[model samples]
Target chain A: MKAKIGWTTNRLHSFAGITISLVALFCIPLLGSSYYDFLFSLALIYSMWALGYNFLLGYTGLLSFGHGAFFGLGAYTVAILVTKFSFKPFLPVIGIAVLATAFLGAVIGYLCVRYTEVYFALLTLAFSMFFYALVFKLYYWTGGSDGIGIRPPDLFGLRFSAIEYPAHYYYITLAFFLISVYIGWRIVNSPFGKALQAIRDNPLKAEAIGIPVRRYKWYAFIISTAYSGLAGALYAPLFGHVVPDLFHFLFAGEVLFATLLGGYTIFLGPIVGGIVFTVAKRYITAVTIYWPLVLGALLVAVTLFFPQGIVGTTYSLLRRKIGIKGGE
Target chain B: MLSGVIRPTHGKIYFMNKDITGLSPHKIVKMGVTRGFQLLCICSNLTTLDNVRIAILSHMGRIGRVFSPIDRDREAYEKALETLKTFGLDKKRNLLARDLPHGDKKLLDVAMAFALEPKLILLDEPTSGVSTSEKGKIMGTIEKVIREKGITALIVEHDMDVVFSYSDRILVMHEGRLIADGKPEEIKSDKKIESILLGVG
Candidate 1:
């Protein structure tokens, strides 16, 4: 219901803003080093996942710690199809990935959304760890901790290898990222999005107003996981490997951290947060083996000083400086 | 228990000749019964119109439409607009719920309940924090809307004057028990009810 800025002057500003950034993304592969392009592609993938994560954490106010399971499932689906069967079709693979995770998400979300706050978080964590163990311990089909490998295949019958693949995949990642953002924008601007925000703001009130809060959450969970799965599917080809680590709770924590860092309330926060995190992690790991310590310290700083998150704080400051009259 | 916000330890709830005991709040709403909170429960981040629009969307089961723009649901949007107009909130439709005054916030809460178009509504302290001068007006608006829509309501209020004036039938509670249930006149004349309400035992 924070619809004051939607599709108005605020909407046009954001539309133009995202368009400019996306246009910049189109130039990254042509202008930047392959390493930079690869890293940017990875950031884009993370943005997709973070956007999905925001649906629960930001919009619906349900914090999940098990989304890595969906991510892993997506990776595993692509890995299984491409490696085991040598499947080449890209769209079907994405479809399978989304469907698989949505099924899993629905089952898990049904159980988890019955609780709120810490209970919900713990439940999602428990379920995610369950998947981590499932993939880790299942040595036969999953190849144990070794995971499975994938290759950059012909996308819609247009083949590209090592040198050409980065650009091709970058474009692919960009396309999907744009699609995901468009879908998310449409969703949050819709009445469904309003209801989810309402539930986030006040679950009791949402229920009294006839929102089937749990059911809405279940649907949100499925949609969110489907997006995570799409990101995961994209991730597998980008890295050319699908490991059990993808399922690990640690990866789930990373997704959570990125969303939090970005400011969950702001529309573009997670995407910007993902890029920042990717850049920061890259530089930090190069200099120190204790990257976690550096990252943790940074997180603490952000929490202490910028609780609205990077994008959210920046937006608020900009609005205040410009004298725009609206509460975030 | 009837609205299913709370479960009775040792009793069954029936609505429209069906047992609704232990049904969830949503199920109760689906059965055409709804409730409003004692506190300001409207979504603070949304516009006044959006607060009601969300209720309408939930009622229509269109909250699952992820692809279509909600504004494109022009019929529903216009209906919500009309609803806001009825509540005199149309002029402030674009304003966020949190920005509304205390009296208006309370009105928005009632507006959301009305959006559900329920057969019956349970209002918990509908006028709790409004200024003394505005309480009657708020209640008046609610009663007028409810009567106009032909909806039944069970309101929990502490103000005896408002209760006597507004309610067609009355139920009084004391120490977690129903002390009296009857016409307002009958309640005023009852000795035990008088003793408890007026401290004139």
Candidate 2:
């Protein structure tokens, strides 16, 4: 048996990750213009969202087609707080948004966790669409299909809106992204995360051991929703608008696609995948309208050939080449 | 006393203080109870270590923060390894349970059950199809695990010799109704047990 504690390969990997992240943080601004900075921030935001989705789908082995509901709820909460209530400090607003979404997630997750696989996916999708319809019908609160326009707030009396710089907003987005990434990392590395993977692998055996599988799964779903909601909340300021499109199934599909592209086994895979996806969407949409078709084809190819996903497959190849075996 | 696998109706069972009477097989497993299937319920895709790890993880309190250290993971891994070692599976830890020979998989399944550390471990036909040479080793492992781990094990076995050898007490079920309960030697001499096994009672 491997020793419990040591300066193992995992430690080395963590060091490598930190070095790369620090280098990227310093280099991105130097090498690219403000436009690239903005796109990079957007990529980071989507990566967080996709990572959240991967938590439920990949780790817990539960498929949800309605996470857009949580995303939309977060966006709406932030929009309402900032636009109508005139909330100034971003932290409290973001906190309230996460809390509200977590509560919503708890309710939906309670209902959906009872089911598995396709049925669970369908249930979440139904609930999401139900909320979507409710938002559409409640025109006074939601502003109907047109969505509510949001203006960036002054952070501690420092007005980014007055400055009118994309770089300023990019920094704000980066802050949110980093925080969300850290929280997500903490969640996936926790003991709870291991239990969720066990549930995915063999739920029955999990229960027999005294782990409350349903409760754990419900908590997983809620956390995933809360994280996705945080992403949506950050998004309101990033785009300067909150729309019903945030709640659409298409948005959920995009996150799912990103998850598949990244591979859930490696923690950083989705982030890399999200960057690739955003760049592809940006460059492809500029030239062609049928971008979904192209993206769908690419996803199919990835699914068919690299089923373990880009990160998982690459990690396996690297491990084989390096003659490193077992968990890292 | 630990809860028995209570059958409230046909095609239904209640185990480990849960009303699993109408729950799906998987749901029943999720509820802190399970019956070892006739064919071992090991994941064919993963190694024996992975299988036991999954089983240990299934009973964890928090499923969301799985990658984080929870104080239980190390303990679980240690316990699982111990169970595997008890079953002589420590050497084959990296090998997939499915790829193992039938006898080894059976031993692995029992070890996997031990990894669950269940309050009541159910073993269905535990010694079935074992080679005569290996039956003693398998039975010895099962007996040792129950004693060492303090687990209440309920073994359902058709092999009369194996059953007679290890059971401190025996419960003979014929057509779902328990027909006898006594020490193994007492059960061996019972006319009812003989009649039931002969299909004439």
Candidate 3:
């Protein structure tokens, strides 16, 4: 009986917590500066990306070091469509980008997910670098490292100038980000999510329980990479360009680091991590020329002290005190 | 040999008159055979109930549900509860599996295998970590549940008393070769068993 109170209150507190974040997110446009819109837009995109990526790593127990390939693929597809073919309107481009990434992700994930630990990581890394090299070498089409500049697509025939793009794009990103969160929540609390978590916990046992472990991991990998593609699709118009650098292994590492920083165990941990990484990286670079050094030091500190990441550690501490537990 | 965790070098395993040789563990499980490890294999971080619930959900072909909240699946939870009630772990259903005592962890491991509702259950040291006093109780429960469900149990046990008391038939193997196969009383009186296994002349 007493435990029920604790669980209910914990659920209420959890509900309150996510609601507060949504409220904060919904009001960003009210601040209204182009810079605020742009910065928060990137943060929201990254958060959505991390949430999607976490399905493969956090829930499904597959560590992918090649996700940047899909992200870049999405961006490149959108950029090429807009810049070369003069593809108008926002929605179809993103849909196409998502499809492109999902199609490729399904291929790559099938081969990669069956391998555990280091083998899986290396194979994904290899695939990502291959994509990076392909774009880099195909200078004419991809525009190489110089990249292709992107013009904002018309929003269903409502043309918006570059000056007005940031604010409008921020709102679009916010909507998609909210949708991603809801979808992520639905997934993690579902039976499919339970099997993925079980696979993460014990593959042998999961299989013994009649779960097709390999197939489920592959599904998660496809879903995760598809998310990266969506984030990339959103990113290109905001940044006004797409580059082969987006597929670099370093970029994949950064995404992984950010997710870990927020704590992969909690559902919102990666979002927090993504937001913190984007905002902090910008400020840190502005403060010092050796920003990589600062970020590296921060990573070391976080790894040593807050290994569970911010939300994970805080949630656990809260649970310890209040008899609350389970994934946030 | 049955659930295909390890491939048999030279023999076929027939379950319900189907060729199940070298099939994947999940495939074998799908064919109505479940195996529990001697080493506890339950998801340690999840609640005790959830540990069993995974098997029940999988058995019910609900593991692929993407839009449904598992917590809202009252039927799954009820089934999980019933499985726990059989193993006497229902009271600790909310506690994390890792927090369970060694004996209870073993119980959870076996409990998960049984949750599959398989036609045959292969238990590898199901009571190895259990306390002396609790061993008989757990074995009694295991027997009762298996009998009630009409599932055949193939148990690998080091405890001679448990082997003697529980098994209707006994197969004695020495160095990968079957030496004796008979009813418990028949095997107990075999000369090779008397000389080699029991260390009695």
**Candidate 1 ranges with C-alpha deviation above 4 Å:** A1-7, A162-164, A325-328
Candidates ranked by TM-score, best first? 3, 1, 2
TM-score of every candidate's chain A: 0.94, 0.92, 0.95
lDDT of 1 by residue, A24-59 (tens): 988998885888778888898888899898999998
User: How does model 2 score on DockQ?
Assistant: 0.37
TM-score of each: 0.93, 0.84, 0.95
Per-model DockQ:
0.67, 0.37, 0.72
Error (Å) of candidate 1 at residue A137 is 2.0
- Candidate 2 segments exceeding 4 Å error: A1-7, A161-163, B1-7, B10-37, B42-84, B89-109, B115-120, B127-136, B148-151, B180-201
lDDT tens digits, residue span B82-153, model 3: 999999999999888888888788888889999999999999878887788989987898888888989999
User: In candidate 3, which residue ranges exceed 4 Å CA deviation?
Assistant: A1-6, A161-163, B199-201
Give the lDDT of residue B38 in candidate 1.
Answer: 88
Order of all candidates by lDDT, from best down to worst?
A: 3, 1, 2
Candidate 1, residues B134-190, lDDT tens digits: the string is: 998899899999999999999998888789999999998888889899999999899
For B83-165, candidate 2 gives per-residue lDDT tens digits of: 67788888888775657888888887776666655666778888777788888887887788789868777877788888878
